[model samples]
Target: MQSTNLKFIFDHSAAAPGHQHDARVFSESLLCQRLEDGWRPLPQGVLLGDSGYAMRDFLQTPIPNPQTPAENRYNAAHKRTRSRIECAIGQLKNSWRCLSKLRVKDPAYAAEIIKAVIVLHNRRMDQNPEDLPAPEEEQEDQCPPEEMGTTEARAAGKQKQNELINFFVR
Candidate 1:
């Protein structure tokens, strides 16, 4: 994961193979595990996730069918904010051509290479802050691959999302 400043916050590319589902990989990451264990990374902070991720108290996803202006506004804002990550990824790939096609045969070695590249990417951002790309307009909508399972945690997530919707309209 990356920050709004285009810095790598959590680079768990080694956590799962590239073929794994995005949500599954996220669910298996140590970061998610820590959050599930009631660890708060930041005070009153929430992460914006794409539809592929499950809605959680710490992570917010777009509403599937927005019924009100408030909900629509929330989705629009979410899309805007989430686009930063996408832009960051594009910047990373553009800056480091090697990442475009990894010839590294060993998975472990490739993971190490990715980590090194991410570190270098962050350092480059620090040295040349102006190199960052301007935020782009909303791209294509990311529809959820399947219905996110419903549980008590999901219910809590919905509650958190509603709170955000209210905040937007207010």
Candidate 2:
């Protein structure tokens, strides 16, 4: 599988099931690859994700200064810069009904569905930027979990892993 596509670009894909893992893994791998390629982490920190891409690992790296009252200010700034994919996802989900339904069965074919969704989303975005919602004043964990499928809050780690507990359990 091409890891390039693994990099989440949003679009109509925001609505698919079993997508939380793919989005997170893709974001993680993308960021790690950038780091390996010599991208430096800012001290006050860079908050590098949008909503769907959040996983515990994303938070493991200290965000500049975690204790500051300006909590995640820098990350939020960075987040908006990286939010085009997120806007595309939101718009795609809101605009396309097919995306809301995971009609494909085979895993490989499912990849095609995702690609199609993103491509459509990008095209739409190009045509009408007005439809997309702005990435919020500050990116916070919103949107309740998807029925049984849920997400864990990410805690930044200085080492390799950032472990987070699911809000679903308790």
Candidate 2 lDDT, 86-156, residue by residue in tens? 55445556666676687666756776876876666567656775765443333444443212212323323
lDDT per residue for candidate 1 within 102-166, as digits (tens), equals 86668788888889889898999999968765544445445563244448778888899989999
Worst 10 residues of 1 by lDDT: 141-150
What Cα-based lDDT does every candidate model obtain? Answer: 0.78, 0.43
Candidate 1: the clashing residue pairs are none
What is the lDDT for 51 in model 1?
Answer: 80
Model 1: lDDT of residue 75: 98
Clashes of each: 0, 10
Candidate 2, residue 81: how far the Cα is off, in Å: 5.1
